[model samples]
Target chain A: MIHLYQNNGYNIVLDVNSGSVHVVDKAAYDVIGALEEQNEFHTPDTLKSPETAAYLKERLGQEYAEEDLTDILEAAAELAGQGRLFTRDVYGDFIDEVKQRKTVVKALCLHIAHDCNLACKYCFAEEGEYHGRRALMSYEVGKKALDFLIANSGKRRNLEVDFFGGEPLMNWQVVKDLVAYGREQEKLHGKHFRFTLTTNGVLLNDEVQEFVNKEMDNVVLSLDGRKEVNDRMRPFRSGKGSYELIVPKFQKLAESRNQQKYYIRGTFTRNNLDFSNDVLHFAELGFKQISIEPVVGEDTDPYAIRREDLPRIFEEYDKLAKIMVDREKSGRGFTFFHFMIDLEGGPCVAKRLSGCGSGTEYLAVTPWGDLYPCHQFVGQEEFLMGNVEEGLTRPDIGDAFRGCSVYSKEGCKKCFARFYCSGGCMANSYKFHHSINDTYEVSCEMERKRVECAIMIKAALADA
Target chain B: MKHIKTLNTQTLNNTVKKGGCGECQTSCQSACKTSCTVGNQTCENRK
Candidate 1:
């Protein structure tokens, strides 16, 4: 299957199955479009067939000379011969095999603290309580969680543990102890633990900075953007802005890490439709690694990204891409999270993108040791997959999550971004709709545009 | 960014293991609803 689109003056053709990308001129692009429209593009042999040749001539003859059209057809066919375009999906036979494989838990998002110090208005975890009593993961629970990850992690040598929470810093001591224990186990068990931390910067200080810089593999610092934009949604319980308090600390941590393995994560909402400005502001602040995500909220909520907001949001993405082109040419390039698509060597090359690996392999552990598919599903009891003590008792729910993929989801079957996006976040699918096979339409739209912009940026940079 | 010739390139087919999120290994995916960063595997500090 092939998906064709023109964005930012680049006519990009992507073969969905074989993961080939072609940048074609107008003639070639038009020819592909014509073939796509006629639905005759399957085999290269068919493209050279008499009927297909007549159709191509009838469609593109006026625009191009007959000889040039034939040449374009041959070129497209050559690419097809190389398994680039019109590649058939050979993954159908193995889809069940891949899903039915043993649950190898390689990563776990440990909810170290199910509580937060700030009261961000759009906090999806509802200020880190996750709709449960505020608590912290004791060292014992964290150890059991790590032990479970190792036990279930079949043949995997490297394991990941993300210290996540209302704010992981709220339970700093346990986090430190857990890391120490994980380090001790690494040598005895012959497994390596790569730990990461995500925090709101409320409890970050010189000591915390020093330790994370020394031990943590990666740290995600949360901040929205400019003072007003960030302060509006992410504020303290006292109704004061945390931006002023956190920016300096974040800046310090980023610089200390040399901006290599850390991301300054921000959130955009309807209030900031001009979200590109927030991205630019992050660059202006000297942050090389940055990510600004769209806020997920109820439609009734004031900040929810609604359907009507798509056009402006799409424009914002285009604007950001254009700016990125210029910035890169001037040697001022910075990393934008959504724009960091690997067109060549990423997971798309792997032929199967299982999304966030929520239920089957990557699970979320609450402070009390209860397991959910992922952090987003922590409060939803229906998704509870069991705890660290006894391992996954709800294999049925695990099977349901394992069954989810672009091939199974009706909305994702024809999506160009299917392999790249894997199948979007399953928690989102379950939350916006009752079924995990569904999709959050607004999120899907935004993700599609981002994929386009990301590819555009790649083309622009290669030229530079 | 059209090329003189119809520039076509085949991407590298890296046989990646499945345990890691079939997508790139973006740690930010914890609450990620909209933006899915594709390649998070080759981090500077990841083991």
Candidate 2:
């Protein structure tokens, strides 16, 4: 599939399947469009149209001679033949492979604790306990989860487990024991275990911080920018802001982890339209890796990013891009997680089509040992696959998630940014639209603007 | 496979220019927008 868009006055054509981007002239662009429109309605033998050529010449102000137009059309046909322009049915082989592949659980998000210290207004987990009874994962359940991952991982050598929560740190003992247990199992099972911890930092004392810094493969510290913004959105049940409590601890943890993988993750709401400043604040605070995501929830909420906020949000992204470029120029570059695209070496077409591998390759284990596709689907019993002991009782749910992809989604198939976005968040889709295949339109638009900004950044940096 | 899309010379010229390819070594899974803590590392092998 080919996607066409205008960027910085250049007509850019993205060959989605082949990952090739081209910049063409107005005459070539018009000719390619005309040829594609004709190819859609006619066979290759009758694809060349004298009438369409004449119309394009007139419509494009006759920039190219009749002979030149013919040459351009021929070149476009050659590109199509080479499977770069207007390609169709490119995922047939991929679909076949997916059909035959066995489902394995390679990653597990263990809900270490069901209780959280903070009651963020937009908490998807009903303030971290998943809106059910509060509990912590038992050592037995945690060990069983490890066993489940190891047994079901097939021939995969690297397996991953995340300590997730209302706040994982609340159940710190179980988390520590599980890491040690995973290491013991690694030696016995001949596999490598990658452990990641996501925390709100309210309970991050020196010892907890030290332990995570040493043991966790990746640490995701949750902080939503400045004090006021964070306090307003993410406060304790007592209505107290958490920014003051977590900032110094987060700073120390970030400084201590010399070469380890970590990210200061924040969320932007409608209140902060200029969220770029929040990112800048993190950079100034010496965070080398930062991620500021838009808050996701019901649209009716006053703080949710409404359709009207998109124009300002786009401008904020542009502003952030400018600041990011400036930082690079000054030799003080930091990685903004969202803006960092693998342009030279992105994921394969198959991986892009399949998305984050939530169900087939990954699962989230609740404190009670119940399993779901991912954290977003944890409390929703209908999505429950099974418990660790029972081992995927609802295999059909897994199959359904496995079958989902950008190719299967009607809206995503036509988007130029489909490869990068991977059909958006499935949980968000199910939450807002009641279907995993449907996308959240607001997030879709936001993602497209981000892609445009990313392209602009790439072009500017390449020129420089 | 090589095709040239038209360039808006005026817009291209007026565009602010920057330098360097700011690629990070982290895995795409880690950088995903979703709240899922785990990331996909298959692309790391290709890199």
Candidate 3:
């Protein structure tokens, strides 16, 4: 059972199980609550301002000055005591850490092999453009990059390492060497190490599959739905249809041991924009999780899928979620990373003790050992944090990320989705906006609508 | 105090800039034309 209430004209939804309350506008509160609660709704304790203040003081600790602490605690307590977790407690914390910034990327995707056998239309790395320049990252370069990550991550708990390229498997030897080295370092440092690689399935054979299952924690297979849809966008270097080969490999991967180990990621383009039925095919192929991304490239027509096609995307997502839900109901369990919020039913981005740390906690190092904001702008010049020789410690990486105007765009600061979307993708900001500070408007709106759809579906499912 | 205020203003301006909408012409719902709680209110309110 759950409870609903209103404080300061904001509707608060509380889950009795977790004591989690999501705050929203009074209108949203009424609409969602009325629609969701089939049974009677109850109102729980409304902690008064005085009690709330006392709680805040305790939470903030006793070292603070009495005068300032009293005022701060009063405001914080008022919100937390109410169920407006999103609006009050979340926004309160967001506002308080006004000067603090957190890091999102702990490691970087150093493109060890840019040489790929397949030609995927939506490949981020321009296949023909950087072909000759695509040299394999040597063991020496990999060592330096690993050392940097280990040293920085030593201060933290988990460090992430992702491999990228035209296809990361082209330099499988390097990957094997690095994974071995990373395992050694992980043992020495006592830190959590997670590895992921996104690949077109042309090179993923039985041996490769076993290695990825054992060595790499996650592998993102690029398969865009049905054979026809996949073959059209993802073909061989010689322009031959590679769907038959990929399907077998995908099946081998997803069904490997069990469906719990791998995820299938699809890229939608103008060619197959309305392929919702493809989700069924994905489910049949034994993939437990899937991520659908729109093809983003320069000179690519934006409306490949008509603006109205947004509903179709949601329809497909809901359908897929239903299938997974039914599967779970039947005692088969599957988890999807793309639906992290839905599965966990918690905050979208975890808050830090400090403020939003973009460049500090998370730093991206390129194949060339140049540190950047994240993996998205690996080779982009303007987003460079610093080079590897000096290390990011002495440099302005922390300061730049901490003070980078990216977090404070007028729209972002004011937008309700600020906590969830985080001013859109930083990569899109640098690429399309040409400034790190620019907000990704289209993506932001799309994500908000997507979140709304997810919330509605989840609420409906919970009721059923 | 003067230096701190100037730095705060600069930080505020920088925040506003990095977070401003990318100049997109799409009739996207995310244009964020709707006014929010703290718009152009300066660092004082933000603090």
Predictions in order: chain A TM-score: 0.98, 0.90, 0.75
lDDT of 2 by residue, A1-464 (tens): 56666655656666555455556766677766666565543333343556665655775545667766777766666655555556554564556465446756778888999999999998889887786999999999999999998999887777878888889989999999999999999999899888888889988888997888778888888998988888999999999898888899898999999724998999999998889989989988899999898888687888988888899998898788877876787788888777766554455455555566777787899998999888889889899899999898998988888777777778786777776777777888888888887888888888887776666656555545
The better-scoring model by TM-score among 2 and 3 is: 2
Model 3 misplaced regions, further than 4 Å: A1-81, A85-105, A128-132, A299-337, A342-359, A393-398, A404-407, B1-47
Candidate 2 TM-score to native: 0.86
Error of 1 at A94 (Å): 1.7
Which residue pairs in candidate 2 have backbone atoms (N, alpha carbon, C) closer than 3 angstroms, thus clashing?
A23-B4, A23-B5, A24-B4, A24-B5, A24-B6, A25-B5, A25-B6, B29-B39, B29-B40
Model number with the top DockQ: 1
Instruction: Write down the lDDT that model 1 would get.
Output: 0.79
- Of the true interface contacts, each candidate retains a share of 0.24, 0.12, 0.00
State the DockQ, from 0 to 1, for candidate 1. Answer: 0.29
RMSD of each: 2.7, 6.4, 13.6
Off by over 4 Å in 1: A348-351, B1-35, B38-47
lDDT of 3 by residue, A269-334 (tens): 767656555655686666666656555555446534445566666566556556656666675535
Query: Candidates ranked by lDDT, best first?
Result: 1, 2, 3
TM-score of each: 0.94, 0.86, 0.69
Give the worst 10-residue stretch by lDDT in candidate 3 chain A. Answer: A345-354
lDDT of 1 by residue, A1-464 (tens): 67788888888887777667777788888888888787635688887778878998999889988877888787777777877777777665567766676657778999999889999999889899988899999999999999998898877777888999889999999999999999998888888887889999989999999989988888888998999999998999999999999999999999999988888999999999999999999999999998898988888999898999999999999999999889989999898878876554455433245556778777899999999888888898999999999999999998998888777888888887777676776767877888988777788888888888887777777766
Winner of 2 and 3 under DockQ: 2
Task: For candidate 1, give the lDDT of residue A244.
Answer: 90
